[model samples]
Target chain A: MAHRWKNDLTRADATPYAAFMNRRQLMGGALGLGLIGAAGAARAAEELVPNSWEDITQYNNYYEFGTRKDDPARNAHTLTTSPWTVKIDGLVDNPGDYSMAQILDAMTIEERIYRFRCVEAWSMVIPWNGFELADLLTMAGVQDGAKYVAFETALRPDEMPGVSYPVLDWPYVEGLRLDEAMHPLTMMATGIYGKTIPNQNGAPMRLVVPWKYGFKSIKSIVRITLTEDEPPTSWNKANAREYGFYSNVNPEVDHPRWSQASERLVGGGLFARRQPTLMFNGYADEVASLYEGMDLSKFI
Target chain B: MSIADRINPLARKLPTWVVYVLYLLPVPVLLYMAQTGGLGREPVKALEHELGEIAIQLLIIGLCISPLRRFAGVNLLKFRRAFGILAFVYVVLHLLVWAVLDVQTLERVWADIVKRPYITVGMGAFVLMLPLIATSNNRAVRWLGPLWRQVHLLTYPVVLLAAVHFIWVRKGFQIEPILYLAVIGGLLALRLIPKRARVAA
Candidate 1:
């Protein structure tokens, strides 16, 4: 059966490609419009200016490429995404090396414009083209005992320089509760801005859990396992104190090193003021029920 | 004339106000970058990082003055005060950029300072430098006598803390921050050698 969930967010929320490039022009227009409706229109205008392909592709924190923000863009182009294959194993019935083309054929794709919040307290609004993770999970036939869904990225040491430095355990891993994995909002992105996903932005395939901090949406995935036990994530395993098992974007539950109360919006240009971070990255109404009564601060 | 000798006479002729103007030059360039969308995606973060880097560079340059005078016979002691003042200015600006623009809340700023180890060390370094910056004048140098020298010894520890702060703030084993720590360590090592051994060498 096809996934029946309807995305409430529409194309209207997405910034046009030309408008994103000409943001200064848009800002000037917004300023003129700001006078008509006062502060509210100006604030709304600020939200519409999306990150450029250059910004999205360049300023990424893919530790697999390297630790520096620019390293991914500099190094990821060498990644051989064309012949990629995903190994679906563990509690699933259908388990094998599914080619990228095969995976794309298995599900229906759609575009989603989402506010992406990173654990480092930076954010961007991206228009991603992908299908729900549940659709693919269902296609694979998730077994009854599976309580969690674990994902892994490719560990090509020669191609990925940062892997050599032990920045993270090679073949970076991430997981979600079975329920969270099955949620309609959980996505497997293949492209951005209506183009094939850039190498630095996780080429071929990647996860996009909008409510969680961006790291939770692991990049360049090659293996996905349906497990009965909770899987060890990369950052959480590296430093448990700094990164929690559930890396939800919560303003109240601050990261040990920095405040999560606010995030600097990317592409806002110089002097861009920080915007207050929302609970579950403003998807509390949709995703909050998944956690229920659990203490987020402790989990965080 | 050699580069040092050539620069010395011009440096002597220039007014003290030149130091202030030279350091302040980066401010407008950064502002222009911000306005023209040259700071890439996160402009505020870029500005804050640039300011912090400048502060650290200035502090390192200030530490180098003594070694240059000793080894190279270039006495730039007159501009030493200017370097310290400008470094302090950049430090204050970096902190303000983080507090006002990045964090955007007084409560959050205090929370970060208290909870974050990097912030704690960075703030501690700033506090240690406060008395040194305050006493960097002719009046304080003459009035306090040898007590002023004792108080100014805080510079060594303050610089160490600042270097440690830079290391702690990085995400991974980045070489840049480690390089900074090595530079500071080398400067401190130079200071440790006996004056008699140094002169003989």
Candidate 2:
């Protein structure tokens, strides 16, 4: 069957055009400074590059590992990704633990380049390699009563230091409406840029819901429960006023502390001009129908 | 001689202009780091945070001046004005980075200051510092005399507002901002102690 969601974006389109121009200007300034080595200057001139894996891996908010952005990179190495098991239960015919090998063998994997927008008003273009989340749920044989799909992250207190502190309720959890979870765009990613996902970026497998805020794309997923009720999400539970359960990438809905009207492109360096945030993060055409006849502002 | 008596002679030898130079050093260093991508992926946010942190640190240090003299016998009164002015400068830079670099629109900036309680508190702190910064000079100090101390008393509210601003800006319950608030609160509390008891101790 032809996929309804066709990816018009190539790897070249990952970084926005303005960011490329900004990098070029920055390269010129760097050369004038004579601080950058010839090798550094050459690397800087490369256009159409997505944020390097370094940026994606190093700058993270994997609170299971720690709260600070760099903490995950430094601390996530302790996480055991190999021989992982995902518990699939709650309104499913096959309600049991599925091993990584079983899950991978039963699914088809593909690369999906997506715009990742954080609620903190920063964004990155991530090229994720994985399979549609629906495939996994189908494998679990989701029952008729399932209205929501809940996900839970692996909670190993011995491995994750951030759990020691009451940052948020441990074993970070997230959820999506069953329809949204089954959407073709919703992916269960196991790799990034053609490599095994780094521990810092949620090793083994993670959910990637591009249209929603990044937190909705929970990391290091260990459980999938199809339920009849809307499951509570970590951020929403932490502060419902700021983080709504829906959390669609809506520019109009301003986060109480900061403006969501615009976002700073992560790889665009320090001086890059802020770009206006897109409605549904530029995927309105595909996902807008899911929320028809509903007020997004209220849902958000 | 007491340790503070010995420290006082060394402290006296330390020039007031050195405070300005030392405190102002972070501005260029941070800009250079931002330019070179040393501040990680989100440099604008990092720069804003660093500047705000420095401003708060300076404000805390400025607050220590009186208590240090009254209790510790370590006089740093000469550098107090320098610390206050430098902190104001960083506060201005922090606002500029958010307004000019991060937000980048006048309407949005105004809207944020009005709508966001944290930004409003931050702006209130900035506004409260204006008079303190303006009068942080010898001529104004001479002209205003006793009234000058009363006017500068605004620092208490300014520091409280700044601490609240920091606490509110963070996404989750972070310990660092809370620690800053606690330290500031303790420093402010010290000012309430009886002067005779403080001197006697």
**Segments in model 2 whose C-alpha atoms lie over 4 Å from true places:** A1-4, A12-49, B197-201
TM-score of 1: 0.86
Query: Candidate 1 chain B — worst ten consecutive residues by lDDT sum?
Result: B34-43
Tell me the tens digit of each residue's lDDT in model 1 across A12-59. 756677876786566557656644233323343354345788778888
Over B1-201, each residue of candidate 1 has an lDDT whose tens digit, in order, gives 776797778778878788889998998999788677676556787788889889998889999998987877677778888988999999999999888877766877898899998999999999988999889999999999999979987888888898899888877467778989999999999988899986677
Error of 1 at B52 (Å): 0.5
The alpha-carbon interface RMSD of model 2 comes to 1.2
Candidate 2: fraction of native contacts reproduced: 0.67
Model 1 bad stretches (over 4 Å): A1-3, A13-50, B1-22, B71-74, B196-201
Residue range A67-172, candidate 2, lDDT tens digits: 8788899999999999899999999999999999999998887877788899998988888899999888988898999999999999999999889888788779
Clashing pairs in model 1, backbone N/Cα/C closer than 3 A: none
TM-scores for the candidates = 0.86, 0.92
Q: Model 2: how far is B12 from its true place, Å?
A: 1.0
